[model samples]
Target: MDLSGENFRIMILYDFKSNLTVQKSFVRLRTAFEDEAPCKTAICNCFAEYKSGRINLSNEFRDGRPSTAVNIDGVRRMIETDRHVTYHEIQTSLGIGMN
Candidate 1:
């Protein structure tokens, strides 16, 4: 496989083993793609963060307004959507609001 593919595979394994929190995972993703251009890095980080379950990407908004102070909408949405979902589920979901 090419270097890029090999790197991604390594990242996936590392991500799975680390069991890192959303913020930490996001930081790692940023570091991973730091060499890329700004726009590419931002997109990569956003997608990576989502895939790592460190953040939530849902349609539900908080109180019909975006919370500018703290970002918990992702957790709130996940909890509301399925209260039975475990803490790990929230952690593994594609959103970062989980605690």
Candidate 2:
């Protein structure tokens, strides 16, 4: 899996396996990484997941629509048909948004 920030997670996992408390792990990370360390909440969440049997550090899918699904041809046609259309109009026509 991607090891980008997994190093920190591995540190957490190691501390967890070594029977350290969450606060201890958080302190260890802060000592090791200082400002570069993930937030305390991040440490807690990652540690919680690992405790719940999630061992890997890859990204998990969260609840949300994909950020962008624009149809280029559809947008081109809409713009060609009406040059005055606003961005919201195009978004409405394409049916893609946070809602």
Candidate 3:
């Protein structure tokens, strides 16, 4: 099963409070999740960041490319060009994946 947001936060907190080495923490977390925990690399990275005070248990907003698929002008132009245009057609013509 996928870890819920609450469980992920709890895992972070557990890592912090337990003060276990990354490997040990990963093993414990894996056991907690019935061997379906997140990858070791991800767990280690997050633990390192958290120990270094770079991140907290709360979710942070990540900066990345803003979405362009929902452009108003593009949608308006598509509608003007064809009232009965299917969403698939718009996606294909605009080369935008469903987000």
lDDT of each: 0.52, 0.77, 0.71
The TM-score of predicted model 3 comes to 0.50
**Tens-digit per-residue lDDT, 1-87, candidate 1:** 223433443454465456665455546655756543124343355446556565433324312235544347877888899989897
Question: Candidate 3 residues 1-99, lDDT tens each?
Answer: 676654675676678668877788778877878656767776777776677676555545422465454666897899998999998988888776776
Could you tell me every candidate's TM-score relative to the true structure? 0.27, 0.59, 0.50
Q: Which regions of candidate 3 are displaced past 4 Å? A: 60-99
TM-score of 2: 0.59
Best by lDDT: 2
Q: Where is model 3 poorest over a 10-residue stretch in terms of lDDT? A: 58-67
Clashes of 2: 0
Candidate with top TM-score is 2
**Residue pairs that clash (backbone atoms under 3 angstroms), model 1:** 53-92, 53-93, 54-95, 54-96, 55-94, 55-95, 55-96, 56-95, 56-96
Candidate 2 wrongly placed segments (more than 4 Å) = 1-3, 59-92, 95-99
Ranking 1 against 3 by TM-score, winner: 3
Cα shift from native, residue 30, model 3 (Å): 1.4
User: Residue 40 in model 2: shift from native, Å?
Assistant: 0.9
